[model samples]
Target chain A: MPSSATSNTNGHATSHTKALAKPTVNQTPNAWSFFAVPRPIKRIFDRFPLLTYPANRLPERVQRVKSADGHALFIWCAPEDASENRASFNPACLRWQAFLKSQNLQFHTVSSSNHASTNERLPFLVVNPSCSSPFKSNIVSAHELAKWAVDQKDSWPVELELHYEPYMSLLNNEIRRAWQYHMYLSPNFEAFTAPSYIHSQTNSSVVRITSSWELQKAAREDLMKSSPRIDVEGLYASADRAFFALDNLLKRKRRMVADVSAPSLLEATLFSYLFLLLELPLDRWLDNRLPEIARKYPELVELENTLKKQYGLQPPAIYDALTGTKDSTLNSRTRLEKHFGIR
Target chain B: MTSRLNLKIWPSGDGFPFPSLNVDCLAAIAYFQLLWRTTDNAVNWTIISDWDASQSPNGQFPVLSCSCEKEIAGILNIFQHVGSCDSINGHSDLNSWMNEDELADCTAWSSHVLTLGTQLLDLYLFITYENYYSTTRPAYTAFLPLYANYTIPPAHQKAAEKRTEHLGLATILGEIDDEPRMQPISLRTGGVDPSASASASFTEKIGFGNRKEILSKAQKRMRLESIVARFLEPLEELLGKKRYFLSNKSPSSLDALVLAYLSLILEVKVPDRWAAEIVENSKLTDWIKREAPHIYGNAPNKG
Candidate 1:
């Protein structure tokens, strides 16, 4: 988390004179001056040759939507996709989507890539292209959505208790690592994740393959930080333990739901992960154990089902269908031959 | 079936617990202490102060060479192996006594502490420039053999860097990620220490001389505030007014894990006391004052 603290540098006249006289501290020594270097030496080094480097001209890769619509949440998705019964395929995006629905914040989903958001991640909410309002900002990025949602809701009945962050850390580290491993590093990457996130972005085989490899590599590197390798048993077992803990919490207290019936961020968070795990198309998920792990906790499955019923946002992806393998009538060799126009 | 049990763990100093230097090993030690008490000393084990992890099952310790000729590594597996012994009557783990929920929470919190809490320790011990030079590095010498000492601490610090790189805390912690490893430390001593000495407020900014330095100082403080809140506040909440983390009556595996972290943060004599200063005021201080001596025995004289 970057701190928003801005430092006020008030310059003094005396200090300015001192700074001008001195060679300056905390900077590279100029060839002329020796101590912080002396001001005379600094003046001498000021004549040294300077080189200029090219300023970065690379265009922003993100989707730029100019609030042409009211309350559109930009997320990673395919085109012509309606978000009915379709939860976001991305857990980060899905969490907010569920939260928005649970909070009854009126918004339509826009299928935008991660590049569209200022944070370089997705699920940013854009408010009021149709109207100008001082009450709300133009864009609410992913992390800011919770506070943003609160403002959108005139009354938040319950305050987030202290236990929220710690327990959330449980999912953030344990379950997230497992999810990353499953989606990007697991055997399912070639079949399911690649086709869904990377292949769907472009028809170019080179772009798709390269992006897929980079994505998997990044995931592998991330996983390797806490684990020796993609330790399947260890990651899954940790996630299972986390699920079991969440299950117990759900049973003991309705932390996920703020009121007796009003769902909170907790439900949104747990539901997004559970939905991805349980509802992800199984055939495309080779050697996948996340769904199996999540299913052990009845509460998790119930949460997913309830959230799906309320939000009606199941991820609009059947990976097999997305990749045109929904016609299981043809075997792999025939499918390849058909793809290439071979008789 | 008469093979004696031997646990190879990271070595620590004489005054602190035997396996105190590493938090994971400390947790394992606490579990062993519990097993010893629960089973009435029926199960005995030896602690081999080993520096090498290459032979360990999971490439780390506490590797327990059990009587059944099985070499088990990782704290949880070690707990399972010992708890399953006939002496303990097949509890299977120290956490097995917990109800399903408590047991699950114990496991989850353990994972939480191991990753995030351990990163905090990494930041405190390995990342901070002065603390690493003046405190943590020398401590490594007391724990490892000479040649091993030279190679090990750097490797360990490098791992810590890789582990928490995503946090983007290097600059805040006074470490520059891309700079040559030693260059930053030497340069920081010259630049940061003078400001800190001039100001003489150890808890405050290292120095905010210029606009860039002022911004860096503000960022450092902000990052510090957030990290302490994110990691420690919940721990404080969970442990509010309790003797142990889960129960008022007895200590659980969770206590052992918490003990591992708290003892290091509070007891380790780091020059950079920013992290400890924040946690010191929290409920953790009271818990440590009450429970640490009971678990790990008295602290060694700093003198």
Candidate 2:
């Protein structure tokens, strides 16, 4: 019963709809109908198969599950550039899809073939850039499929959900903690670190469990909990996917290759390394550098337990020391030369 | 001389602006002070050449008096005081061979002061004289008032002006000076004939005596190669084998100072570039987060 309003900012008066009188859910209205589809999504549709793509064609590819009322989200993902085979699979898209799949609901992925991609889908979330969708930029941008959900909000049956994942460097640990401390201060949405980061410390294999009922059961049993493994997969997969996509995109265009120098590659590499480092568990790092930290940061102990349970780990060597072991006898230059083929 | 000095430093408690925060001198001072503190050595710490003299008592001691004779006198006075101090050993010369005790205890204070003070003085002189052709006149104006307050008033004032002008010319030559300046329009005032009063006065006022000879002598006196060799020897020794400066402890001010000087000097076009770089290049930047992580609101990477 949710009503929609045409954006007055653009002086467009025709598309106004009233709020849902018989509200089924507490959902925010879509404001992105006015803007163009995000650049990446547009590229996807433009490269859509000439014939209709089967709703369930890529079964393994589609990971999100349907909600209790049979509502599942969809996001359109495409290469940042045309003529590139690699798609920048956003981490959020993968997480959301995984969450949905765990719910065990029947859903459809309207791929590059779908022409009716709009933001009217109810309970259907869009992870588009904040401009073109109700969802904020932070979460969705890193996850193109999330952005697509926002871009195609009008096609779903339920309320639209928008999410924003901030750039990683923007939030330091304490600030991020403070943000989590007062998440409810904002009425519309919530924020979370990557699932892979939450799961990074443990060695558990997280098989997606579907259904709200099942999710609750798992939550009660502490079967699937916060661990760095999930975060490593989520964050690293997204960055790596994006990196490959960018790499593929750049390789195709002579202009970008000619213009982008060695520094840009190094910049990208640094970003990748920093993200990997940040995703690592502080407890493991602390154990190597200062054992006193385990006593000092109590949250780390709790986090360590959660990670151990999630990853099904029974205490392994800390990550840094594992890497540090290789460089013990051999110098860094030699190691880099041996492993990375760089001197 | 007054017996006991009670110093009230501005922006005090840990991070004070003395001896140029981005330079090696502060680190040397920190080490010396740390050593002095541990040993319970009694040293007279005074306010000298503070950027803001008005912040000090009577607004005189902190000023770097400009008169050539006065500056030279000031230099001599410090040496004389150090010589008189019971802490300093007066007998030893660099040319003589030294025993372990003599090296460690005999001239600890004087030798330390001499080595550190010489570096600072050389840096100051480099910024003031040889590099003056690239410096601006306004920045040097701070020393004017200090020069005016010296024992020999006019002489000190003139020396201050000379140093300022010398520095100004060096700055105009576009070298070590990094102070922001007004952008004047480019005009071909066409080459001024030397006979013209303006050109003649400009030459007479700005020119230094026997420039090449002075530079060669200064270079020899300072032993640039030796200092650079020593300065880089530690780093070179650790290169490719170790990461971060100082093999053991978390980065200290000394690390930042050395790194800042090298980084900043390499990128002189950026005003305060060298100073800022010293803070940026190594683990020093992250040390700020490590020591006081809450201030920046981030946990340091132990990895």
Candidate 3:
């Protein structure tokens, strides 16, 4: 609980007094505000739901529909997408969406761009927004979404998290670099990633081109942090090796979507990366070796195949693309995944 | 093959300090040493401890410049280059004999060490307040020129800051810094401050009265344990009863990677040695004692 000073009074009213008290040289309150910050300046106070933000209004609201549902998850969804049945095309949002589904939480994924999130990244959950007063913070960052999910549940997949951190390094380093390299830096960017992330959000040619350049530049700068230049071959080789290692580990899973009790958070992450690698048109580039490497593992493909239906994650077009009229059954079981492992 | 292979890295400090203070550079040297052991020194590689890292492709140290191939930077790239050259004579790449499963396990564990293991080492050597300032900072003076030493050590520390920002360890590191400074009222000064203590009860003046301080101290211990445990526990579980990580007969790339980080933590004498203490008591201690000397080669100058 907050101390009495904070608890006893309305936070906003008390906050103005605190802000006024901050400087030693007391002057007129209106004197020295920066010309740039844009009026009514938001402030965070030491009270429950500390952040105070300006509400999104007018023209922006027309394109982006705000769900009044307290459990609405704002994600890196397409700007027009509203259906709960469709999966989030973006991997970052889909990870959380998959996790929430596994936890049996009924959240409607909101169609949002990166700017919709509190931290200006996608996949932030709006927690009880209806009860929140105007301009009061109600959004939970993607970083804190897992904590929120865990807090709500009585039973958790504790055993699956046994050695998650080390396994996490596999996903964070090798697989992540490969994914970034393919999506942003490779020829696949123009064919697939640009359509999904960049073109879908904007229309002006200048915005599309510059945003594409800026996004790829950011990925390049991050890649260059660990090396002198992007070693494309090295990255693909690492991802291949990572896939094989994950395949070795994935042999333990009988099914997906928390698997009756396994809630590793690693599962959600693996699913997101594997789903995109297997399902998306990332192989548009000649060097797009990730999809092939991802397919070599049967367990990985199986995990994505089962988890999609378990979570209702097939986003219509992808569902059609995946189950293309080749409805052939295996020795006994009928396969939902028709495109993968066809080497 | 006749001409010497020049591998440049950051030089060792005097009097048995590491061959390189940096983990990647250290691992790079250990990698070559392993290659020489298995290949009967066919590669003719020389470890040149040069301060100038500007010449390399990556603009970083631990670069391999050979007469036959283009100079490559980074440990893995260098390993790749050497692996490419393995077919010459009877020289075979390390782990070339292993089946697909073993090779995959080796790569996975090595990746683990390079990622999470690097973070843990950074937390210990560079990120912590007391250890960097008191010990690791001054130790750099012996290896680097005066101006470069000041610039380079801090660059490592700053990079460590960026690397570890995601781990949520800053608060615990802050508490750990305040541990020594949180002396009792009587102990901090020659005795209790008379003016300050006058308002307090008898128990408050003598010290041990601050429940908040005691509580934070306990909390700090648990947080520190948990933070280090997240990195080390899986490693401990993996290393149990095996002579090497996932192997018994011969050391692979994973062994070299783990040993590179392990030797530094055990050897580098830092004032706040909590991390080192944990490693000393871990499952890998015997493995370290036996393998470190053989791989690093006791004489830093000999390589």
Candidate 4:
């Protein structure tokens, strides 16, 4: 009765009827006809074997992963083409892919946005069932996927395990702050990151603007949490110290690769942050400090180059934009100038 | 074995297990009761309506104290915590009708309501001078001592103003005023009066800023109407003829959220009833009226 009254006044009476009509039947039922499905038919439909789809299906030969902005979720390192190493712009996705590659796990990349993710984040992993396990394909991300890898015995050795939490905290806190500040809070957000990353995640202009605002607000709040106010100078100062510490750590060992023959979890995490910072087109926004670190630190640059070769990651197009590399066809200089108003 | 769960909310001026005055407390209680009824969980929850929020973990209510002595603050956190507990039933029968896609839709719609609906509520109750002075301020500070009543309302108003500014809606709507503008009539009369030459001079000194403020406020109110319209139209379309917002099945959490906001907007009496009038014209009013008795166990008296 309430539905009828509301529908009549709201001018949705027709649509209401249409909404209730199942697609296959295409017959509009009366207002009270929700109970029209006979009890025997319901029972028979429930018991029908063909009607029920089996929960488990054959595992896919390759794993499918979703990244933000429909970019490939892996570093594309073509031996023949050094420029092809830059595929995905998302550092988190690159980190995840690099970690998987370091473990010698085989995965195929697919372009997807954060909207497809269960957690509304980028870089989710989908594991296909193998002959050894009958479990269906499972989608996991973040800590859950990390745990899955651990369960499969693809984890850091005990020596590196002691340093995992400390190093992770370092990267998550100091390095993450710098990254968020560089990407979201910086003035370039409205010009570059917003259009390139955030806007591409959604088609709706309202959602895009609102989401960008919320994301920036969250980043600001996070930055403010450590201090009374946002001290950009102090933040960068600490960031410089953090980078310095990381540079020293990597410099001492020639590479972060330990005696276990596999790259430690620390190396994976470090590479994730370092590669993102070194590769991103934040040259215009950044105050020359981080870029200076990449230039001055031989070990850091060497590690990045080594990882690019190891993972077969093609340099992303953003790399060309940052380096002012001119292409014969598109002319990168003109494109940057026209779009970003940079001469 | 059933575990003892205690829910602490803001104390009500009137003695009631659930206060109808505070919309958040009402919604929290409604959400708790709905979950309790739909699940086979042995949750012996006692509503401590008189509890103060100061003792809470985050200095806000409603706080849920679980059997494990972990205090979860805020309604969302409390719900998530309780839902994750082993004692409570994992899945609600209300949500069983929805598929994964429908559930995702429900979440998106629920977020929309929470964000826009709360902003609308804030605008109606706190930003508009008429409603703030006549209704919201009194509702929050009436029970306090004279000194506290006088002090707290302005503080609360300032905080609300700050929040609106942070959300950027205030700037877009042009409500960011450093000081309240003097009336043009006061300036005009002072300038015209022969004996009040000094007052006239003072009026002239501040008149430009005052005029801009008045004009901006007028412009903002007009713009606010369109913003509210944009928010409501999509929600109305999504609801369509379904009993719930996004699902044809039983009421989900999104239903509870919609019911909470709609009921609050309709039932709460305020001087600036622009938002309430808008709600009255929509199908949401009828939905709230229909669901009130079932959710709250008693029909809420419309203000």
Question: Which structure among the candidates has the greatest DockQ?
Answer: 3
* Chain A TM-score, structure 2: 0.22
Q: Which portions of model 1 show Cα errors greater than 4 Å?
A: A1-69, A82-85, A130-137, A157-162, A254-260, A281-284, A320-343, B1-5, B13-18, B55-58, B64-89, B141-151, B175-226, B298-303
Could you report the DockQ of all the candidates, in the order they appear?
Answer: 0.27, 0.02, 0.29, 0.01
Tell me the TM-score of each prediction against the true structure.
0.75, 0.21, 0.71, 0.43
- Weakest 10 consecutive residues, lDDT, candidate 3 chain B? B175-184
Q: Model 3, B91-184: lDDT tens per residue?
A: 4466666776676566666777787777788788777778877777776777678889878777767667767777777656634544544323
lDDT of model 4 at position A281: 49
Model 2 gets an lDDT of 0.29
Report the Cα lDDT for residue B252, model 1.
Answer: 77
What CA root-mean-square deviation does each model show from the true structure? 10.8, 27.6, 11.2, 26.2
- Cα distance off (Å), candidate 4, residue A303: 26
Output the TM-score of candidate 3: 0.71
Worst 10 residues of 1 chain A by lDDT: A1-10
Report the poorest 10 consecutive residues by lDDT, candidate 2 chain A. Answer: A158-167
- Clash list (residue pairs), candidate 3: none
For candidate 3, the chain B TM-score comes to 0.84
> For candidate 4, lDDT tens digit of each residue in A191-256?
446655654445577887798898799878666443324545444544554555555655544444
Question: The CA-based lDDT of model 4 is what?
Answer: 0.58
Superior candidate under lDDT, 1 versus 4: 1
Task: Give Cα distance to truth, residue B240, candidate 4, Å.
Answer: 2.1
- TM-score ranking from best to worst? 1, 3, 4, 2
